[model samples]
Target: MSELRTEQPHDDAGLRDWQHVHNVIIPTHVLSLAEVRERAGRNHLEVAYLDDVLVGCSTVRPPTGDTLTATVIARTLPAHRGQGFGTELYARGVARARDLGAETIETVVLSSNEDGLRFAKKRGFVEIERYLLPGDTIPWIDLRLS
Candidate 1:
């Protein structure tokens, strides 16, 4: 893999990254640019690039108000899936969460997505809960950050 670069994306580029990854992973669940814009307003977003090309993105919505933990969502584009980009990005996400005093980091993976499941487990996350979505059940996995 080429040298990895990570950054907090700005405006339009951030929305595009969100939409692009959403479309790549879950085509049935598309997020409009406007929706991405709205989410960006509420979440911390980061994008990872390999050799200057966007390869993955990560978002973490830190606990606030009634919530006590953070939720992290990360995805790497198809072509860049298993070359360690996701893992690198996740490490940064966890670091950020720790800096923010978050006690736990939660991430969900579709039950059918074996790669995602393994990825989470490999990083010391434990399956803590499961929930049914429209057509699939997802496991809510978490890692202690504190």
Candidate 2:
């Protein structure tokens, strides 16, 4: 069975472990540990653990007036990917947003990231808009859950 654990952003050791997992799992985004820590410190960040092992993390920033912006950076250790860690992380994030009085949550994903899109779809997220990256023509999709 898997277990989920939630903690504040400044928990250095937890954030470091999460950063390592994220670096290995996400191909396009090369986020540094410092960046992850900074974001976690800015908003409500949650981490998930499975038997003392770090598995996933998510960051949610509640906006004014019924909306929340969330970015979930989670990675299951290579051996745990198919066990639903990602889904659990997302569920927790959405629940946290709702608890914070947000009626809607928004997320963005790269166009080429099929796995992410699939995960979002499974979590009841629908594409609401598409925009190009600043320096490139690569399209990114914005998904919303309401």
Candidate 3:
């Protein structure tokens, strides 16, 4: 059986593992350990551990007094993918945003990432806008949860 636990990004050694997994799972540029530390320090970041292993991480920035934008950089180990870890992470993030007094939560995903888009939609996030990435053909879709 798997269990989910939440903790601050800086306090979780498993965040490094999550970053490594993210680098392997996604096609986007991966953040270095130092960069991840800096982002966590600047934002409200959290990690989800399944049992004793790190499975997901999310970062939330307060873009405005009433708006929090969240970015989830998560990856389940190969053996653990497709087993609801991402959903767990997202649910935790939503709860955190509410606790932080955010009236809305926003996130962006590459249009090519169909799975991510579907997941976000399933979580009640609506597509708000789309923008082209500089010098790249890929388009990014912005999603918001209220």
Candidate 4:
């Protein structure tokens, strides 16, 4: 095991890798490459690797509106969980959010991802709300660090 290697998705390959992790982890909300490209234009997106293996990806949505709220979501592959990749990605995301002048931080998790929900709770995130998107059956939970 080695320290996780992460970089902003600047190339098409990097973008694809990021999108792969995201879509795999959040199967309920699969994103296409073009969708990822659009998100990259507004959000800070990064791909995480352990040596040459893809481990995860993270997103930091900078503070917006009057709340100064920023959103950080780290998605680790099922095979890569319990290896600290998510923790590293999350820490980097929080730091990036603060750097962008965020006053409040939050994260979202798919209801079915028990690991993700547990990860958020262990990090002092309290569930603020849970709601389903249009045409979705499973709900998404929104949590805020408290």
Candidate 5:
């Protein structure tokens, strides 16, 4: 196994890398190039590489409004899902959020994603709320950093 490395790619390159991982890991939820560009401008985007190949990606959005919480989202390619890549990406997000002075960290997972729920629970996050959106019921889970 190649050593895993995480990096914040430059704007244009990061968008392409992020979109590629998004499309591969969760095709149904893949973001448009425009959305990827927007996110790169608004969040901390990290791409994980195993040697020279992109294997995962993460986004940690800093708190906004009156909230002291940061939001994290990560995805690893299906071929790499159970190999700890997702966990690594998620941990990086949490660490980044803490470094940014966030008091809490949260992630929203679709109701049907058992693996995501399990991953959050394993990381000490607890389900706080479940909202039924247009096409999915998503659970909001959080972990306090303070």
Candidate 6:
């Protein structure tokens, strides 16, 4: 397997790459470039590649509030799943969250993505909630690391 390379998106092209992976993986909630830019300002957003091929993206929402909870989301293209891209991105997100003083780590997965749900569970994340966002049909599952 090619070594995964993750870059914090700073340029337009880099940002677009991140958006592509995110929109593709979560078709229910596609994000435009403007939205992605907005999110980048508030979160750590990154795009991942494997030997020059786009494979995934990640978001690390730094710990906030009295709970010091952070959200880490790793998204991999369907074609790239099971190749360790998600694993690498997830590890980096967790590390970054901890570095930012997270006392608890949480991840939210769209209920439709069985792979993501399974990945989070296997990593010791327990389901805390499963609910639908307003106007959305599919529910999202929120899991916290044990």
C-alpha lDDT of residue 71 in model 2: 45
Q: Rate the local accuracy (lDDT) of all candidates.
A: 0.74, 0.69, 0.67, 0.94, 0.77, 0.93
Residues 1-146, model 5: lDDT tens digits: 57789988687776788789877755446679898888888899988889888898998999765677898887787777898899889888988988998877888665566787787777777777775545533433343332
Q: Superposing all C-alpha atoms, what RMSD in Å does each candidate have to the true structure?
A: 2.9, 2.9, 2.9, 0.9, 2.7, 1.0
Model 2 poorest 10 in a row by lDDT: 66-75
lDDT of 1 at 117: 73
Q: If ranked by lDDT, best first, what sequence of candidates would result?
A: 4, 6, 5, 1, 2, 3
In terms of TM-score, how similar is model 3 to the real structure?
0.77
Candidate 6 or 2, higher TM-score: 6
**Better-scoring candidate (lDDT), 2 or 4:** 4
Between candidates 4 and 5, the one scoring higher on TM-score is: 4
Total backbone clashes of candidate 2, pairs 3 or more residues apart or in separate chains: 0
Instruction: Identify the candidate with maximal lDDT.
Output: 4
TM-scores for the candidates? 0.82, 0.76, 0.77, 0.97, 0.83, 0.96
Candidate 2 per-residue lDDT, tens place, 1-146, comes to 55666565467787786677666655556678789877676777766677787776666776555344554434456666677777777777767777877766787667876777787777778899998756645588888874
Considering only N, C-alpha and C atoms within 3 Å, which residue pairs clash in candidate 6?
Answer: none
Per-residue lDDT over 1-146 for candidate 4, one digit per residue giving the tens place of the 0 to 100 score: 48899999999999999999988887778889999999999999999988989999999999998989999999899998998889999999999999999999999999999999999999999999999998778999999999
Steric collisions counted per model: 0, 0, 0, 0, 0, 0
The better-scoring model by TM-score among 3 and 6 is 6
**Pairing residues by index, what is the TM-score of model 2?**
0.76
- List the candidates ranked by TM-score, beginning with the highest: 4, 6, 5, 1, 3, 2
Point out the higher-scoring one by TM-score: 5 or 6.
6
Better of 4 and 6 by TM-score: 4
Q: Residues 19-74, candidate 3, lDDT per residue (tens digit)?
A: 66656655565668877677667677776677877666665664565344444433
Measured on C-alpha atoms, candidate 2 has an lDDT of 0.69
After superposition, candidate 5 runs with Cα above 4 Å error = 65-67, 134-146
Give the least accurate 10-residue stretch of model 6, judged by summed lDDT. Answer: 22-31
Q: Which segments of model 1 are wrong by more than 4 Å?
A: 65-67, 134-146
